[model samples]
Target: MPPRSPAEDRAAADSDTAAAGREQTRQRVIEAAIGLLEREGRDAVTTRAVAVAAGVQAPAIYRLFGDKNGLLEAVAEYGFAAFLAAKHVDPDPQDPVEDLKAGWDLAVEFGLANPALYTLMYSEPGNATSAAFTAGMEILMGRIRRLAAGGWLRVDEQLAATLIHATARGAVLTWLSLPEDERNPALLTALRTAMVTAVTNQQPAVRDAGPAGAARALRAALPEQTTLSSAEQQLLREWLDRLAADG
Candidate 1:
């Protein structure tokens, strides 16, 4: 080996710095892509579209993500990461119930705000790594496991948690499909209460006629979004299937 010149050392440092900067820009592009998908349908998203939304050039997207498929994959990963961060969901050590509630609320809010991104993060066949998805699941499941271990959860920990999540997600999606008038505050309250009851050993009023009836009434009151195309219907069907399979 030989000693490098001062210029070479500076060049090496600059290379590392530039790599870091590129990574940051790449992350930004992915985030922007996710936001675009959330606002519009997934079909509306394209490489040029993502670059324009990300405030980067089309060439820059190719350089960062390699291709449209690659960019979409990155966007999936970005979706999960952003969901976790946006939820401000801290992993609780002491109180599992509180932890679960916090996670659920954040997840619901994210789904309500960005249905496309929410579905893609978990259900869509995208480039999201299995480990990445596992870690995301653990963020919510860790609490349920802890509660089960402590005998805080009434039913089978895994099954109960899955149901609670499914119910919450379905309820939220159903609500989103409705007109503003169809968003019933009473139903929302009941569903929230029922969700809490389902997870925790402590029974709430929502466990009985409250959540179940409210959910039914909410459904009855809602009319289909005529704007939903055949593709969107198929997308929702696949998403529901994925949820069932995951459970």
Candidate 2:
């Protein structure tokens, strides 16, 4: 390929700058929409209201987000991104099971803290397909994979993920629906424990050994396996370290 001329180089640089500016503006608008949703309710997140809050014209909202529904989707994505940021997944947690509990608690606490945002992100099934939501699912899947590799999983990976999500979602929404006087802390604990029992095997898959021991064996033999790719082996190794520490 021929080297770019000065004019072409300048054009490329200008294009990058413009793209960055657009992304910044998009973030500002999403933030404005989130603020409105949290403070004044979802109905208050009108195009006019968001435009005023973001200091942009209504047409800019349309130009950037396409329509009101699109703006709402962006708001949902922002909520997912925020939740993902708060989550601290330990690549090598000492106890994978305990780590799973902690992760579950964090998600529930986030929903309780941000009910409006949580509702917006999860009330409809469509939001599950958003980029941010998919990213969060990937993190959950990693955790599930760790459980499977450690011989702690009772169900298949996909079923375990579904059960975890369902339990958490049910717990949060049910707790929120109850009257203040009827709300009980045990509800959350019960749901979490139930989820653990439903998805995880109390005894490790290997006889005469527990999860930690099983994890070590798997870690040692992981290199001999050909099913998983190189990147997967590296990640599984980290999880194995955590499980071995538990032993």
The best candidate in terms of lDDT: 2
lDDT of each: 0.66, 0.86
TM-scores of all predicted structures: 0.66, 0.80
TM-score of 2: 0.80
Indicate which candidate wins on TM-score: 2
> How many clashing pairs per prediction, in order?
0, 0
* lDDT of model 2, residue 222: 77
The total of clashing pairs for model 1 equals 0
**Candidate 2, run of 10 with poorest lDDT:** 204-213
Residue-level lDDT tens digits of model 2 in 137-216: 88888787777666777665667799999898889889888999999999999999999998877866656577665775
Pairs in clash, predicted candidate 1: none
Q: Model 2 clash pairs?
A: none
Q: Model 1, range 1-247, lDDT digits (tens) per residue?
A: 9999999999999999999999988988888887788788788789888888888989999888789877877767766666766655444466667777667777777777777876666565543455555676776666665554444554444566677777777777777778998798676567767877766666321244343332322222223445667787666545533432331
